[model samples]
Target chain A: MTLNRVMTVDDDRFDQLAYRRILKKTNAKIDLLPFQYATEALEYLKSPTRRPVDVILLDINMPRMDGFEFLEAAKTELENQIVIMVTTSMDPQDRSRAETFAPVRGYFSKPLTTDDISVIDRLVAQQ
Target chain B: MIDHDSNSRAHAPRSFAQSYATALATYVRDGNEENLSRAYDCARQALQSSISIGQLGELHFQAAQMLCSGSPSPSPETKRTEEFYLEAISVYDMALRGYGESVAQLTAEVLERKRAEQELRDVTYELARQRDSLDQKVKARTRELQAGLERSERLNSQLQQANQEQAQFTYAISHDLKSPINTIAMLLDIISVDHQEHLDSECLELIDAAQATASRMSRMITGILQYARLVGQEAEFETVSLDKLCRDVRDDLRQEITDGKAEIDISPLPDVRGMPSQLRSLLQNLLSNAIKFRDPGRPCRIAVSAAPKPRNCAAEITVSDTGIGIPEAYRTRIFSLFQRLHTYDEYSGSGIGLTLCQRIAGYHAGDIQVVSNEQGGSSFIVRLWINERERDNDTQSGDDG
Candidate 1:
């Protein structure tokens, strides 16, 4: 199936809900695939049957494989795809680390509301 | 010495014989005649002279006895022999008189020599002892100086490293901080300015969300800047009046507290010493924080007071708020940069306000103390001007220990 949406990979259910709620008002035709578990998210992203995403909202703090791990797996293959990190963490080192991914767009902290997803408009426009 | 002693004769130089006799007499008197035999030539000569005098006396007496016997036919040869004996006795008596005089003089000289030797030995021993003590003291002083130099070097390097790290931290914060904020802000500006009225309800929601995020970001950047300034990254300090400082700060926060829900009580604060702009900022942040974090149902009451230590030498100012007080676990955590106890939805804080306040106190050679309970509110005590004498008094506070 052709997918023209952003995937939010987070291990916490509340965070997924929050990110999904924030993404609802965006004018972009985007679908949000929230993975509460890391392994499942990685499996879905690696599957050949799934179409590539326009952007990925990866949370920094997670169980199993974190956003960093997901970024590593999708390294060169997801070069064209935009990755906007979404998490409650404000650590400087995490932001610096995310810089390694050329496609990594913006970092957003939690309690994300409709306004925070405008980065979607920005990122899609850049692509 | 010549004018005081009145005895110029005592200093006459001794002949070899006189010197020998004086040394022997001195050694004997002191009971240390270990080399007396080698040094007694003059004393032996004096004894020989005395023996010669006794021989002369015996000869004279014998001649007189012969004359008294009146031997009529005295031979010319016997007369000649008697004359010779008399001459020999006269010469021997003269030699003995000279020896006696010489020995007496030598003995007197020996006593003087003994005193001189005793004084020389005492002075030498004393000098050696003083030299040894002086050497030890110099060594100890040099070692102490070296230790002091090393400590200074270590302190200097540590200070340099700390400064470098501070600069880097500020730079990193400044350099990377703006890009994200500007990007977010630019995005918001573009959407709100370009596509606001034309936007549907859903699109309008995006604009609102972006504005909130941008506003929150701007507040955080301001908070971090305040934190840096408070952490001694800012330069120079000017004297600030306490009463005026508090009033100015209160005035500055007028817009913040004008929500009119807060009851702020500020007594006259005593000024000691500090930077006004920074202090005002500190007061403004603290006052505003009190108003911002109050209980929703109850009206917020804030009290600001200062405690001075003896004639305005040092002061401790406290800011207390009757708000939903911090939990016991969160007290220590509140001073860390960007550490927030409450979520943004409940309370709006950049989380760097108290952290900056503490850093400011430290920069002014002061400290901040926090006290609070779960039910009650938090009171922050800031102390300044901690000098040596005050520390001594603190140590002597009658605690039995």
Candidate 2:
């Protein structure tokens, strides 16, 4: 199965570039949609003409409408998509709390390694 | 005695017998055989009067017991001595019947005294048990009170810590986000400069200026976050060797020192209790400031020394620099956040170096003060309390914020 679309919600431009680079290295046929703010990502999801996203990489730390707030705002609309929380926070409580949301499937720390990318690849193949 | 009893003449016989018995005892005690015989004669005369059998028996019994008892002088085994013993035995036999009644009375008195003694012992035992129970109750009450006091103290400190953490979280949220903004601005500069041949020099210069401002803002933001975090961070306290801390700070700023031709002289320093990171940052800020504000004409000379504060037994660390000294009027203002005596071009800094140092000093329950040195330079003095209970008392008086 080929992955069609992936969206990233993050405030940091550097992290957004790094995540895209990691995915590009895998040569996966996935369209990347990046949002500099969680609110923008939520708005994009709410828009009528938006592409169907297969998976979302959500960041916990953001300027306005944090990743959790975004999830709360778009939980009903995100029923068909898988969400993977991405954060630089070392607090384990953040991951545990994110997992309680039905749409969230996994949590990964910052600077996603090759193994993390492989795990994501396998998970996408299963879907 | 006869005059007092003249009206009680019925008691005459008994009194006379008692007097004869006394005379017989006196003669026997003195070992006077002739007087003893005369006393026996007086007794026989008294017996002729009508004394009671009990009294007669008591009188004879005493005279007999005294005769039989050995005298001070040995009595020779003579016929007269044998006769005296015989007479004493005969009188003793007659007195036994009367003595039986007196024996019963004496036995009854002894039993009553024993019962009274047993009752006294039981009462004493009960009083002792009650005292022990009361003592236990008092001790239990004291333990409960102590536990309650400790719990309240713990809760109070926890509330204070929560308040501090809330304030820090707000400041860190805004300040920490600047790091990414700086990175993005630098990346923009790199992209523009790498393709300078395709772009105009005027545009490239503008990008460079933007990059420089972003980097400086990044440093300032970091400083702001660091200052704010000092309130909430529960950094572990350990024994810090001030001399070693100075050496480490010197190593970290080696490049700056070489660029400025600065010399750092650290004297023997005392060990104190404080967070290692905070103490290191405090020294780093002061040292970097000294180097940055150095007089360009001469080599920069910095001396780090320590002495004990007499009032609180805390170590007083003094970092003195032979550079442009701070003016007396601006000394207090320099320690405040973002308060700068010089412009960014004049002396490069985030303008929070002294503020960070002051915050770190406060974290250690200490204070930082600046004074003009005799060598015409600035001396930054930081006092740190030793690890002890007095630190808590001293820390409570000052506001960490």
Candidate 3:
């Protein structure tokens, strides 16, 4: 299982930037693609892309299409892509709701550190 | 002639017969069953004392004729009406029996009267029994309604207690989450320093912006927790001097006053009974607003005055300032939580200061309002009743805070 492309769906630009910095610092060789809107990201996944994304970093709180809605739509549309939920919400109910999706591999709070990237790296390697 | 003379001798004393006639007349006139029953008792006594059946029957026959004529309706619904009908039947039956064989036609009349009396007695008995049962049912229904009302009241109080507990839980959660936000801000600062060589100016700015947002969020959360804590707080009430309170608040805002070039004048104020800390906050909020919303053209001039309102009804403490007056439309809404009239750039506030002031005033059984001053700026008046006993309506319970 050789993985290459990586994708991130988050509304916050800073958070997306943080992920870019963390991913570059932890594993620079991995390919990264970022989307500000969940709907656009889902559309991209549904399209006949040349390379399928191996991992997706999804934020739960967003404008129109939230993280949960994206996961539900992406489940039937996309092939095997590991989802790692990224959110600033401290709500316990949100964690339980996120876990309901089969494709979700992990969950982490905002300001994701380099240590968190290592854990994600290991999870991606398992795929 | 001798037998006739002896009859006249017996009729010479007519006292019992006269008394019985009078009672029968009263019963017929009033239509009261009790009176009719009394008439019957009188007749029975006269008979027991050797009054002739012929004489007793004649008196009863007259009473029966008067009662039958006085009968208002046929279907006796009331217990008294039933009694009257039964008594009338009994009197007529006895009168017919008195006629004996001397009046042969009365034998048919006696049989007819006896049959009618039996029918009426059965109907009256049934009606009386039904009335008694209905009375019992009404009493049972009343008891059921009273019990239901009490149960709902008890449930309502329980619901109120549950709501208060839920509020406290939410406040505690917000209070606890503040530390994590601070930690995140601190971590971002550290990351900026550690990656300075690798990071560009744009990246450093983004990190700083993120840290600022985190700090702002923490402040907002703290404001919410403060508001929630006020709902169920129990503070000891004391007689506080407003002049001293204003002085203390001025001291707290000394730096702001100096920066804004503001002058605060305090008048002789009335002593009020309330929670000292809450009253101080109320004064501090109003005073801070007076300083914050000052006109840039001139130095801020604020006067704190208190006067006993006419008729000794309530004491009014006014905090008048030389600041831009608030529009009348926004005056009422300003007391609401998170309602800000100006942007964060123009006014630096969590928008919870005035809200807290309103809550504190409510706790002390007072009201705070802003009105335009004729001399320019705004006057925020706080009306407080002198008598603490009248403050019962605004008193806070531990569960409610």
Fraction of the true interface contacts (Cα pairs closer than 8 Å across chains) found in each model:
0.00, 0.00, 0.00
Q: Docking quality tier of candidate 1?
A: incorrect
Candidate maximizing lDDT:
3
Interface C-alpha RMSD per candidate, 1 decimal: 8.6, 13.1, 9.6
Worst 10 residues of 1 chain A by lDDT: A21-30
lDDT string, candidate 1, B80-137, tens digits: 4344334444454566688788898898889789888988988998998899999999
Tens digit per residue, CA lDDT, model 3, A13-55 = 6688788888777666868889887878988877776367778
Candidate 3 docking band? incorrect
Candidate 2 C-alpha error for residue B61, in Å: 87
The TM-score values for the models, in the order shown, are 0.50, 0.43, 0.49
Better of 1 and 2 by DockQ: 1
Off by over 4 Å in 2: A1-127, B1-162, B165-168, B171-176, B199-201, B308-312, B386-401
Put down candidate 3 lDDT per residue, B1-401, tens digits, no spaces. Answer: 23334445556326554555566556655765578787556645665566665666666556455555656555242334345435644554575576555476576777778878988998898899889889889889989999999999999998878768876986988889988998998899889988888998988887887877787778788877877777657667889987788898999999999998999999888788887877887888898889999999877899999865522225688899989989887788788776666644366567788899888877776778899997679999887752454345345332321
lDDT of each: 0.67, 0.75, 0.76
Query: Of the candidates numbered 1 and 2, which has the greater lDDT value?
Result: 2
lDDT of 1 at B6: 40
Question: iRMS for model 1?
Answer: 8.6
